[model samples]
Target: MGIRGKDRQIDNIEFNVNDISRSKTFYGSIFGWSFVDYGPTYIEFSDGRMTGGFTTGEPVRTGGPLVILYADDLDCTQLRLKAAGATISREVFSFPGGHRFHFIYPDGYELAVWSAS
Candidate 1:
């Protein structure tokens, strides 16, 4: 058997903070989330179940937490998001696991839809 892909779920999340060290300490104390540093600017965290990351970067252009979702049909989902009035903030881009695009939801929060296929 082979591994299965996570689809139609909140697969990952990212947060931007001005101070990575401070954020790390706070989250660690409060939630016990463990982190692995990537560099001076990024750190990945494992909160027992879901994995997420933190970055010492400027706030996202549109603002809000970065919530990434999994989709089976990437193109169709993009079209549907557009039709539903979500603005495409960032075009589809490929990463190690798959491709994804960022959009501003109707409520003005930014979210991403990704496909592993």
Candidate 2:
């Protein structure tokens, strides 16, 4: 194989829920989403092509829903997020060859969609 620096890709996305059972039930009932439980507080679902995990409230809501977005350029992604009314919390910063931003939605909930640039 030829030598390469790296390739950017998304592993998965996560959504925070105050109630895991309720949320899981809702998704399963509505969209027929199947789930795998890591524990009582965690559950994962395959919502269409998107795969996301759910975490129940145990510690606290330090942030909000986390919707993952894969991109080659995190800076460009930041611009789109800002335009969409997401309040910037963490700016684009390179860390170990990746960049990410944490922002709050219009609902005053914080979430981050990270990308490796």
lDDT of 1: 0.83
Error of 1 at 81 (Å): 1.2
The candidate scoring highest on lDDT is 1
Segments of candidate 2 deviating more than 4 angstroms: 1-11, 57-64, 70-117
TM-score of 2: 0.48
Compose the digit string of candidate 1's lDDT tens values, residues 6-115.
65678888888888899899999999999998888888898999888888754743455688888888888899989999999999988656788999889878888888
Q: Find the number of clashing residue pairs for candidate 2.
A: 1
Residue ranges of candidate 1 with Cα displaced over 4 Å: 1-4, 57-64, 95-97
lDDT of 2 by residue, 1-117 (tens): 111222234446677778889988899999998888878778889867767788863344555556555555566667877899888987766543366677877888766655544
